[model samples]
Target: MTRTVLLNNLDHQDLRVITRRSAALGDAVMLAHTFPAEFRDLQAHYPIVFQKSADGTTFHPVALLGLQDGQNLFLDESGWTGHTLPLAIEREPFYIGQDGDEWLVHIDLDSPRLSRTEGEPLFLPHGGSSEHLERMTSVLLALHEGLQATPAFVSALLRHELLESFVLDVEHADGSQGRLAGFYTLNEERLAQLDGPALAALHQAGHLQAIYMVLASLSNFRTLIERQNQRQAARA
Candidate 1:
């Protein structure tokens, strides 16, 4: 079914929908071809391509986009993942279709998960730094630069406990099994003790920016997390 969503705050103006598409080559690293398509509404000038996935699917919506879809119809369902959105696109490609006098951009949403990461992920120590705010700033810049280049990478960093020191989860093409690269919020352990208001307040601030900074400098996320822990330990 063709869905349309209202395009907002972009170089173009139009309504669009989040349609699902197939997967292609580059997507193999980060995604599983299960639901290889995502939702995108782009302009006529945008270059759309129908990539051939590992499967026989000829058309897929794995293109990196810069705008958000108005109608968010494809959200999480049942026990699977909810709202499989794109957090990053290694490259930008779309499916261009000419309909009557108007041009339409299209993609299918059935892409699956990447083969490399089929099992459950094991937790590891973070190594981001705080002693060097300059380093953090640099990392933040890089993440933003990366996101800006990839039209579909929706990113935000946070600076709150539970949602602190670590944030910014980018979407991979893993369908329901995609990982939030260089980012993570609260873990299963903190679920019950989590504070909702504190988290909301951080969001109102610039926590998203903080987390993205952490992602850009994921090489140092562990360091950052360690430093935060040390500070809390001293305070306690």
Candidate 2:
């Protein structure tokens, strides 16, 4: 369980966050939650897809990192290979919390990234927030807003009937195979067939580009597979 408490400089004066990418630091994830606002940057390095929520209530967008659970192909000896990382992945140890009607920032005390002697400082010597903290605040704000806007984006896609189930089959060089399922993506056929009025509405809402970005990101599936194969080969 995550132990969360409201962050304050007094209690966390010496708090530091290790920014290095490593599996032991909780960087190994199957997929990271993303939003329409991040699709453009994320599409360049990761495959974007939508999956049903835990209760099957709704769907949210995610950037795929690996085919299997607890495996992130992006992490290596040096660091994450991608130039751009999903905001959800970058916002480690820090999370947004709700205290009644107010939003607050909370940090996981048990996270490996939390350190007192190494990495970026959360506060300055004079007890003011550091530049790193400011950037993290901005990221959290963007994430909060982006998550709030995602339902509308998903509604738009559902209204246009553009979401379709997808399955991926992978064949490794060593005669191993894997299949990925339980995800959805934009159907180009349906997107192209959208009526002009619907298309116009989506365009007006700034969702058309996001749809295309999600589609474009599918190409990264090959990139992920290659990474997995490379890791497998290295282990052999």
Candidate 3:
């Protein structure tokens, strides 16, 4: 259950949020929704791919955190091992809400991260927004804008026929095997075959770089497999 309410300096002056990354705090996710704005940072540590929306009508970008359901290879006993976390993961317990023509911040009171004591305070002693709150607000704003631009990005990819379904096969040192499917990746061949004008158009739209970032991110699949292998070895 969730107890979501608009955030204000009053009535919730004592609110605090635990910022630790762990599975118990709901960080164990196989994938996280991503956007072109974050591609450069995310590509360095995660394999970016596309998955269809729940209704199967459109596609959206996501950062692959693990090879299977409910598994996040970047998370461990200490914390998240990745250098950068996707914006979706960083903005926890806080979300953007609309009230008529105005956008407001909302907090989930039911979140496990919520605490009256022993966490980052949302406001300072005089009821001013804390640095933590300000940072989270920026995160929320970026996420809002990024999500708003996703549909156009997806539409561009589809118009150019640059997406192709891919299946990843993995084998651990212990002889265990797994297959990850139902995801789409950039069709490099198609991208390369496009005419100069189309290429320029994609570049002018700022998607060409994002497309390359997605390709570059595929190399991190090896990193994920390595992490899985290490986990298996530790358990052995």
lDDT of 1 by residue, 11-75 (tens): 11221221223233222222211111122221111212222335642222222121122211111
Estimate TM-scores for all models.
Answer: 0.21, 0.96, 0.97
Off-target runs (Cα >4 Å) in candidate 1 are 1-24, 31-87, 90-158, 163-185, 188-197, 203-236
Best by lDDT: 3
Maximum-TM-score candidate:
3
**Residue-level error in angstroms, candidate 3, position 96:** 0.4
Q: Which 10-residue window of candidate 3 scores lowest in summed lDDT?
A: 96-105
How well is each residue in 1-236 modelled by candidate 3, as lDDT tens digits?
A: 88999999898899999999999999999999989999999999999999998998899999999999999999999999999999999999899998898888999988998899978999998999999999999999999999999898899999999989999999988998899999999998998899999989989998888999999999999999999999999999
lDDT string for model 2 (138-204, tens) is 8998999999999999999888788888899999867799999999988898888888998899999
The 10-residue segment of model 1 with minimum total lDDT is: 34-43
RMSD, every candidate, angstroms: 22.4, 1.3, 1.0
Residue 23, candidate 1: alpha-carbon lDDT: 30
